[model samples]
Target: MDVEEENIESDASHNSNELGDTQRLHITKYPSQFRALANKFAHEKNLKDRRKLLEMYGNHLISFKRSILLNRKRWQQRYLRRQSFLRSVFMQQLLELETTFLELIPILNLNGMPSKNDLRINHSSDVCTPITRFYKDLLKLESDDWLAKFHMQKSTFDWLCGQLKENGQFLGKNSLMGKEPPYERQVALGLYAFATGIKYLEIARIFKITLRTTICRIMKSVAESIIKTFGDQYLYMPTSEEELDEIGEAFYSASKMPPVAIGVLGVCEVPAKQQVNSNSIESENSTIILQVLVDNNMIFRKVKLDTNQPSLFLEETNEITNLSPKLIKNQPVSRFIVTPDTYYPLRKSLMHKYHDPVEPHEYDFNEAVDHLFIFRDRALQRLFARWRILKCNGDIDLRTMEKVVLACCVLHNVIERNEKTFNEQWSKGPHSDNTKYTMSSRFKPVLNELHGKPHSWKADGASETRKLLGQAIYSTEM
Candidate 1:
């Protein structure tokens, strides 16, 4: 491609509008610029110049290390002072930081790899030498400052020259496609510290780096990185039967059975009391109903409701009798809307008590957004894999297959938020004549299946009801 075409491709790939500085550095469209920048700052011409430059950068590096060490010490102090609340938070942060930094090492190493022939570094000696030296000094410092041993010797000049050739001549920003720049590294380290919730100084020590760099990176960079890289993916809401099944399974595995779940939103009127001791059941004003399905194996079946759906109560009330008769009667519902709104108590009761979740309401919206986003993402990936497998296997009824394909495509497109990425594939429009052939070819079999088979869920309503009731019961506290 020509420069314009290349630029377009590069722009598409890099797409800085959403990415952070660390990501931009990794793309390295301007290796030459980074090289020049590094060179302009180097101090060493001979060994002395190398030492001076190394000393300058070395101080920063040492300061960074010290800050981390100090921060860690402070954290330990705090933990000792408070064995209860603050300590757990401190420990949790440390673990998160360690995991993030360790994960980044491979990316950094890949980016920092040296060229085979040293073509770029040698060709751009003016800039390359200084940049190379800066790293060499870092390495030297790591190697316990070997220069001290060679100091005051004739070999010092030769040693400095050797270091200059090797140290200052760095692989520019693009040297490795995935690695980050020094500045980006600073920011990432800071983020690592923040995420780990370690004492800032301690995190600096762990990374062998600076508090200022860490602070700046977290405050200005990491959140954006997470957003750009993970964005809507982090906000994925589970929508598929398979995904719901997996969640049910997870809840089942994590908690116990007999879970209760409310899927939709609506209001329901509940009665005050049932027949007891030969007395008539008392009438009561309508209260919010939290329609839940108590089930073992989850199956979605439509249930007719007598009144409005459930509603959330803002304050505690003993008027439990005002709830819908259907709910009070404990009839199993396939999908029930806990009217008004679902709150934490109901959510916890569902998850911890029963275990089924149509959707989670226990956490904040942002938290829910983040979680469901991950859940849906993993589910879609599984769907994609399944689809590919099905396609590879071939020979299924075309109409049935088509429905599955279309559904998969529709769901995947919605959940992945990849409209821009898959624009070409979907641009014809799902319903367009151009897509009709492909759609028909795959969906014909799915339609045939629908015709041949009565809905299994409909026939199995009783068993499904049992399962739904179990889900509902398990979903809440008694």
Candidate 2:
């Protein structure tokens, strides 16, 4: 048996050696295959463990996701609540601020209540105490000085004041509360200041008024009052036959001609500053033409103003044509006769004696008689020069100028009627014989036919009238 065992052992040893050798050979030949098989087995084991872990934690993951979603929703709700609370607080604050501002408005004294000094400066200075003092000073002046300054005597001023008071409906009373200036004083100051062309500042100083605008208002009020009071009384045509006869007699006395000679026609040039409306027509000499008709007594029968010199003559004729038919009762009164220097239209009815040297005798005779008629124009000129306001040398517009002239004319008539003697300065004797006739460019050839077409019959009638008048005039010596 021992021998058999020994044999078996030897064989096993040999087999073991053979196996080892074979294994070595395989490893050397296929090492990559061995490594890949090992890796595949390890990966499969890891995948199996991971799948087990996923199965175990699946419920936990779902619960965690739900909890996160709920927490996020809670945070969002908290944020919205905080924003709403802030907005409400801001609105409440704004409302409170608005209420506070409203409550404080009345308590804030913005313009500091006017002091006593301010009241005195504003009200007392403009009231009537100063005016009373001014009137007292005016009364202290002599009658001649008063007349020279104010263009009317004290008695006349008082009469005018009384008349205006009697006709108080025309000049409304001053509504100012504090003792107001007397109506007479206000009217006198306005008339004197405007007629004399005194500066507003100068007038304010004289009257002790505080404001220049006050003087201006006073002037305008007084002027309108005067016009309303005396316009119709003084500025009307002789209405009755008796008045017409009287005017006719005055004319006959003036010219030594027949009663047919009623008035003289004339023009005066008033220089004015440039007007604001550029489209308005302006004369070449920058003047406004004033056409005036004066009766034998040197009273303004008619007055018209034209923008240009050329239009003045036509306007005068139109005025005369309108007025003549109303005045004359006998015939249609084809036209009227006047001693117009050369500017007047030469119609059969309107006879103009030329100032040519050839007709010396006729010229001399006419000149001697024409002097009486021409005196009216000279007197009118002097009257205009006397009223500086009517002349309007300063900045005055057309409307204001018209008012000034009309007012002055009314005042002129008033003074003329009231005064016993004529003012020597305003009314000098007849113009000198050596005075030369001045021709104006206003007389153009186109304007010659303005008086309408002349007929032979009209000319014959006018000539006969003139001849009879000339015979009558020459028969009587001046």
Candidate 3:
């Protein structure tokens, strides 16, 4: 025992000497120092009783907030899918046909010609368009697809078709040997033309009509039917006191025009098939002007088709003979404002935009008048947008332009009265970029060619009438 104690003391002395007496190899010699650390934990540990619902909801909200890019990508995917479906629908419909003549979407190509196909169909005598079969089952289409193609509801088309039979006097050949196309087919042909504005030949291909002239005849008949059936009710010039009062009231409601202010007038050019005289493809120089008057409701009161130059349609009519005096003379019972952009002939009892108005009242008056013109511009935009045939997409023939436009106007009024709604996406389409060219360059020439203001536009009297109307508009706004 004495020897062991002496050895331990010698070892400690040796270690202390070697490690400078401060360092020790057994650093964890005190195991009780770490007892509290073993008992306490830093992380959450109620594993059996804790709820994850709150965290799940927070994660969902974060995902929803950050999903805008994902939504856009999905929207694009859906649009592409719809387009692909439409293409397949038309292509498969044509491919199912027994002949090659109508196997392609002619309107998809330029000038109503189909593209080259490696698969050639042998020409045969049995080839005929399934127009009857196609027309008979149009109601089977889903409502969205129906509006996309026809620009109208199926019920509306049905009503028009029925009315046409009763009163439209649609010109058609009657024979014991062959059956005429049904009224539904005729209306379909015309409505399709108005909806698409594709070439007549392309229209023919779509309907599988062998002769392009048949398509024209069918379209003309439908136009005539529409004009004949509904023209008197919707397109008449208002000369009667009751009609004038209703129109004036509509204008007041629409643009805050004075009680006397009725019928906004404007001149617009629509795409016309190049005339035989036109050698230029520059569409700006080739368009034909359409002169029109509309009430506050954007309904056409007068449509003077092919008003190539200044229009005399109003003056030449017997109904408006007394209207001119009331408009230009001191009678405040009736008057109209010309479109702001036009150098309209001075004789039409028209009031031009403000030239130079004096004080604060005149400035306010000019603003009200500007709002009036904005309303008119919007009216015209809505009018033309409803009928794409007038927009030059359909390449309307010069001979049939009036009939087509008039028919469209009649249909527009009918639709407006019926309160039909359509998907706005249907109007998005490939319009010819060149069709956007304007003929506003010719307005100065219009004034030049007219020589001088007519007797109705006596300068002093016109000024008083303008001021009276301006004051009325300004007071209304105040």
Candidate 4:
């Protein structure tokens, strides 16, 4: 505005001059000659540095604002995601809760009815008449009839019942709607269960038990009692030298193998309850292997559940390791137990039949070994025969099965020790499979019966003791 006003004033002055001195004013024109002027501090060093600093500060401010905005956006997105996830979780939890309530509603007893019916407390069945009469006249039954039916001689049964009675278990407390069973009745019930493999209900029907659960309790209690009372005495591997020697001599007398052989090894797999396991698609269960060490008399010396792992007898408990090495026919020999070829890593303490015997002496050794395995197998078969309950496919829990099996083994030993006669006809009866076992009365194995399959296993140097044993047997035969 000032410069324009000045130019107007100058123009007016020049107009006046044109009127007066028009020629001079018209020819005169002037421009300033000083160097072009700009901001005096702009090119100063300090000002230049300050300008650069301001630019950096502006850039920093811009970045900070951008970062703040980005952070807000990030948090907003995270909040949305978290809200979605929580909503889904809340919905799922609510669904689960609803499902749980729905599941529980039916089972809830609003009307105050019973949650479960106790079959033991309220049984509808009555005692069968024949069973009542049979038990009443159990003593009047014949010796052979008793043996055939109960798998024990009358005297042996009486002896066992007496022993059980002394234990003073099975109070017959569960016997509802009928007379309480005595100790004898309890023993009879257990023996019947052991012999029949019959269901508790059917056994109840046959035995006249008013409450089948009473029969179950009677059997379970009796088995538990028998195991607790006589398990150690009846089913035990002898560790003492005297006891070992006696057992060894007895086994030697029967098999004519070697005097060092004390026990015969056998394994019987009893059907057990199928266990629900995460590992297997097929119902995860292994048959309860009753790994047994028995003497010549088919008496179980050692009984164990196969949970001890793969090796059958000596490897499990190391029982034979305790055996003081014995001399048979003036040759050094380890007092050992005989096992089948399937059991391996044969050491002095354990022996199996020769694998693929090539020599004549090998055949001879195999013959003698056959007798040992026959007795071992026969003992196991008789165990199955004597107590058919082991064959029952029905669900029997591990603990109960263990008790029942151990109880049967105890009874077997007691019968053997008492010289109880085992009737041949008993093993062929209803509960038993029609498998024929050789006569233990003679302690003899028929050669024609020796059809045992040979194993393809070749013994390594670890089984040197067993190889030496085969050589010694050959030497003894010579």
Candidate 5:
């Protein structure tokens, strides 16, 4: 019975081993198939996850597209509303302009067109028009009163008219119309326009010009005539010894500062049109520099308009080199006594050198006097003040700007020469002198004298000149 049980147990173990071997054989023979099955299951799970992700992305894309369409629609609506508002504003402005035009039409008397004969007759009958009355008043007024009103004495005006006629053929008998506005009337219009800084339209209305263009043409012609006729004659540097002597004498009389051909040098900032090459729109509001030299009498002897700052011109011309002590001491000194405010090379011996006046005790008596002379001798400042009053209010082209400024300077000189008229007009003036003088803080520091340069001179001579002058003055005071 025990043997039988052992056989059974061996058979059972054999059966169990056979079963295990069969399972191992199956796994070894189909290894690739098992792996393929595992990979296939993993791929299916990955596809399911990808499908969920695609659905979520598709939903978001749809929402994004809808939002884009809504934004586009909103922007379109805003653009339409903006267009409608602009259109309404434009229409309102147009309606206002039309109303103004209609109001002016009746006043202008453009309802009915008159025949040429009737127009001529009416024009002749209206001989005592406002323009005519103004001309009559100008004629009746005295030289001082006329100068006060027009900025030119009657004699100077007549002389200018004569000069213009002789040199520029200005206001001569027009070949077609034979002097339409007449000589005196044309000159009066120009002078009045310049002195008052009036626009062409206002001048046209005052002069009874049918078109503003006519007044503009007349003013332009007059300015050109003035420039062509008198630019070289009046606005010139002293070339001859006699001329230099006269200018030096004038300077000495004014400030007791001898050998100064010109009293002051400065840059005047005048409003002008934007240059062609300038890209800045704000440059239209900026000013251009007008470099000028004036005598003791405030007459502009030299004028130059430059796009650069004033110091650049001084450097370019080597003005410091020209102002050597030897050259300054030579005949017809041609030296300019500028204020300490001027930008030039600082020479210790020069009377106009920088001096701090904060501590009066530290300054010499001569230095104090120099400061006083500089402050009081403001010929350039006065010239700029007059210019401010007479300058045109609107921006003018650069080409025309120089001519206009020159013409005004000539007029200023002419007006100044008539001292009696100028004093009377200035004292009993219809317009008050409202010009304010302000010193510019923008300036380059004084340059040092160049070494090993032939033009360079020691400041010793300048010091001696100042010392001698100071001693002379002190002796006279004593």
Candidate 6:
């Protein structure tokens, strides 16, 4: 079974490719390079040696094939078995990945990479030296154990067996390393669960174990293995210019177009259960407000006042007065504008704060999304695709025409829903027909206006040019 013979066997399987399924074929039936490797290393020299080699390789191949088949089977079976279990596992894994990934997102920000000065050792930090010393000492001992465990193979067992035959004291040498083998089954099952979005509790039911124990075992094993294998390799702040450039490139690639003028709005929602007390009732109310920032093709230039202690303020301070002196002196293509009915009033002292040179006031958020939608309609009218207004968590709930239409505005960045208004309206409703007509009629022309814009034929062809991106950033501060 050389490479040429392996290809011949693979060509045989090609005939069944039209069957439109590959899972049914056992892996051993499809020849691989491993077969040649196995034959070259086979124990015997006779004709029977080749047969024995094939048999051993066949078993290994079958195990590999079963692993693949089981993955697809588990995904299809997950929903039918236990729905709650699957949902929890999916949510947990998704959240875990999201949280970890976002921490590194500042690296991908429009602002250039942090300087060497930024990452320079802070000798002033009291705990840094002690923590570094502790980890350095610990890793030495841990590395030895890891290396020893990793290399203990069947050869080690065979060596011990030979020693046992020569001396009585070494009779149980093979049994000296009495530690149980690693939980390969648990690791395999955990990965299967992750890839297929299967729940540990459902897996527990399949394996005849308790739900709690199964979940604990799967998470501990899977998370620990992932940490040990990768171990903060990709989990670092970008300190170098090249690394920062790579991060920015990834962001630009994901975002497609550089955000012309970025409008960031944070929404905070509180659960119903937390609203029992009066103070909690007020606190449970979700807050939604917009932040105006200048996002050129490059980094996000946050307009801050000199007196403002780099505050993450939700209140929208007035644009003309509160901007940095340089921005006021030379307004860029974009100018920042905070909503008037903001949580607070724009103070007089705040008005005279540091203003940087801005690309004079030829830009605003009012026209940004609206302009995009207008462009979307003219250029993308012929496209056929489902238009969804997804929530922050990516749940699409477009049940009504108003919901559908509103979602279109949000998706295309035409009109941002006043979250407070929508929430109040939705919550106060008594399922009145008049209310539906009122809301729908009010926003109907807005949608019609969006759809009625003229197209420029000289530009790109009438393809799906405007692929709408709708991101709802929710605030967890509440």
lDDT at 422 for candidate 1? 24
Put down candidate 2 lDDT per residue, 1-478, tens digits, no spaces: 2343344345444434444554334323232333343345446557876565455345433543454455446556666766666555565466457445433322211235534433332233334322134566677889877667766688887788888776633233442212444686677676776556746545544554544445556666677777788877876655454655566677666655445544566666554433332342221224555666666666766666665443433432443344343223233333354646456545434555545535334444475456655656565654554455645444444555555566667776777677733444432223322333232576443244433653353444655544444544555653
Return the TM-score for each candidate structure. Answer: 0.24, 0.58, 0.63, 0.62, 0.57, 0.22
lDDT of 3 by residue, 340-418 (tens): 4355543335655666778655676566666666556655565566677777542456657778877887887788778
Candidate 1 TM-score, true structure as reference: 0.24
Top-TM-score structure, candidate number: 3
Instruction: Note the Cα lDDT for every prediction shown.
Output: 0.32, 0.53, 0.57, 0.61, 0.50, 0.29
Cα lDDT tens digits, model 6, 1-478, are 4664565456445533433255436433446546554656555577876777777777756665564556456545654445645554565577556445433322211234545533323343211111112112323545333223221122322332243234312111121111222233343333334322334334343322233333344434444444333223322223344543453334334333222112221111111111112332112212111121212122112322111112333233433334322121122212122222122222221111112313212122222333322322321111001111111112111122122222122222211111111112221222221321011111111111112453331232211111111111011111
Order of candidates by lDDT, top first? 4, 3, 2, 5, 1, 6
Query: For each candidate, how many residue pairs have backbone atoms clashing (under 3 Å)?
Result: 82, 0, 3, 0, 0, 19
List residue ranges in candidate 6 displaced over 4 A: 1-181, 195-201, 205-211, 249-478
lDDT of 1 by residue, 1-478 (tens): 1343355435534443334454445444443332342464453367666666556545544553454455456556655545544444454466558546643432111235555543233342221211222233334442223222211122332332343333332223432222334434333332233223334444433333332233433333333433333334333334455654554445433333222232222211222111112232221122212222212122111112222332222122312212222332365333222222222223221121213334343222223223322333333233333223222312222332333333333323323332221222212222222311111111111111123453342353433443444444335533
Across residues 328-357, which tens digit of lDDT does each residue of candidate 5 receive? 334322244453445544332224533443
Candidates 2 and 4, the one with greater TM-score = 4
**Selected candidate, larger TM-score, 4 vs 6:** 4
Alpha-carbon lDDT of model 6: 0.29
Cα shift from native, residue 129, model 6 (Å)? 50
Model 2: how far is 308 from its true place, Å? 2.8
Tens digit of per-residue lDDT, candidate 4, span 1-478:
2353355346445544433353334322211100111122234458776576556545544553454455456556666766766665565466457445433332222224443431223244332232134466777989777866788778777777777777747754335233435677777878888876846545544555544345556778989989877887777767778877787677666665767788877754666655544442223454566778878777888887753343444333366766678775565676777765553445566676778888766676677787777777777776777777877644566777777878888877887788756655556755465653222121121111112533222332325555555666677667
Cand. 3 TM to true fold: 0.63
Q: Which candidate is the best by lDDT?
A: 4
4 versus 6: better lDDT goes to:
4
lDDT of 4 at 125: 34
Candidate achieving higher TM-score, 1 or 3: 3
